[model samples]
Target: MAAKRGGAPANKIISDNRKARFNFAIEDTLEVGIELKGTEVKALRSGKANIGESYAAEHKGEIWIYNVYIPEYLQGNRNNHEPRRPRKLLLHKREIGKLALAVQKDGKTIVPLKLYFNDKGFAKLEIALAKGKKLHDKRETEKQRDWNREKSRLMKNLG
Candidate 1:
């Protein structure tokens, strides 16, 4: 059954990293821009990108997104870029420096949250600074989530 709340249908999300939510505790999140070629941009507009296997790394003090696959455009003539190319993320110098420091000192990693288009029709990425969870932590989180789901279901039925 489709779940709706507040007299509105749920948001239609294109894709999500279900594993990320199950495996990590996200500490902070930031929205960043991706530098892409024309062909890549067109492919993204068609909702043809996946960041599930992607990670962000600091190189020479700049943040670059790696392993995010954007499939080739079928109608491209000859300018298609590689599928797994590393793309530079646009951020302020201070933000880059802070990310580098947090990564190096705290051992936290940046994981891609989701890739989606904003209301302005531009492709944007939501990235998160996450601390990896241990095995027991994941189990506990799963238990809590299941309990919450049951509680909500009971409340709806009773009310």
Candidate 2:
């Protein structure tokens, strides 16, 4: 999703976890705000972060993102944030409860898809409820992707 600001769409992407789509089947998604420290936000603004190996979980009734690597800000000397800290995710109580219960009952895992700044300049995260893809399913996805690429090339040649 995107928001408009000053008559322009404001969705400046910071980091994207492309690996998530290849490894899991995303069933549901939500756009959530992220809570970040000063240094963490500075580091992210510089685009020096990775969320490819990150996942979210509930702890003590709150949701947190784990394993996301936002490197220390170069200008924030002596007061930099941890690079691999488990950051808190800002979500509503009802949504948090539902996501927690979904994980418990349906075994779906919460994965971060993309990180971006919204129109109001607030950091946001796109999270998805996904199930792991089996080996065969992964292989099939690869095969289908390859076929589509080849088909597009052939069509272009014919045209």
Candidate 3:
């Protein structure tokens, strides 16, 4: 077998929704392409996008992301894109059907997890089908995280 010349290309992450995991119980995740304008793409290249409060939804038989803030490119002049426009997501018909069904029947939300540029330099959004966490569930998650951190600290000291 021939040896590969290089490893896989690393994705350049533009934004991450860290609180999404704490607030939602993620069931499934999908990588979907994003439709971007020229200025929007340039803005993202500067790594100033925010997906923390953004979410995806089925609109007119297609998936669209809302509330995502991609700041204007400083050098874009008069051609800058809107900062919080609803952007279309690119997915197959089958995938769109599945997501629509999950939202309508399963009471699940499509939450944006991360926004990044793939190895091929295409913009992508990682979205999750998730159910909102209850107050008790959130508390339990926090407690478990704290316990794991303490356990790791103790083990490090002991070893």
Candidate 4:
């Protein structure tokens, strides 16, 4: 583990990527470390992070997160990292191998599920191996969700 810092542990969520869950079928999740600048880290500490529009892409065999917006730190001037610059995700070799296999075998993609802080105050990303859901699949999921809601309503009324 990296050197622990701050008073609070990190696994606490800073922002969620709800669209990923709705748009894809998540098969597996992996936690990876984010390489962030000092200002970005500060923004994350203050929970000013957004992962909803973020996605991960493999470039030259390394995974980089894209569209993750970390707002400029209030006090930092001229040195703040670009809010949506691609950030590398650090994962173990074996884990990367598994993810690569899954991507190749299933035509799945690794998507960022959320961004959070870990127990040691390090920024962490939850990435999911996911298959994109088709339009009909999305409709079916919504229908099922609605049916479940209605079923619970009827059950509550009867009971």
TM, every model? 0.86, 0.88, 0.91, 0.88
Candidate 4 residue-wise lDDT, 23-116, digit = tens:
9999899889988888888888888788887788777778888888899888899977788899998988778788877788879988998888
Clashes of each: 0, 0, 0, 5
Taking the tens digit of each residue's C-alpha lDDT, what string does model 3 give over 1-159?
986467445688989999999999999999999999999998998898999989899999999999999999999888678899999999999999999999999999999999998888889999999999999999999999999999999999999
Candidate 4 error regions (>4 Å): 1-10
The lDDT of each candidate is 0.83, 0.92, 0.94, 0.87
lDDT of 1 by residue, 1-159 (tens): 975345322222344676887778999999887788889877876666788888999999789999999989878987788989999998999989888998999999989888776655556788889999999999999899999999999999999
- TM-score pick, better of 1 and 3: 3
lDDT of 3: 0.94
Please provide, for model 2 over 50-97, each residue's C-alpha lDDT reduced to its tens digit, 9 standing for 90 to 100: 899999999999999999999989889887888998999999999999
Error of 4 at 158 (Å): 2.1
The alpha-carbon root-mean-square deviation between model 4 and the true structure, to one decimal in Å, is 3.8
Name the weakest run of 10 consecutive residues (lDDT summed) in model 3: 3-12
**Candidates in order: C-alpha RMSD to true structure:** 5.9, 3.2, 2.4, 3.8
lDDT of 2: 0.92
**Using alpha carbons, what is the TM-score of model 4?**
0.88
At residue 58, give the lDDT of candidate 3.
Answer: 98
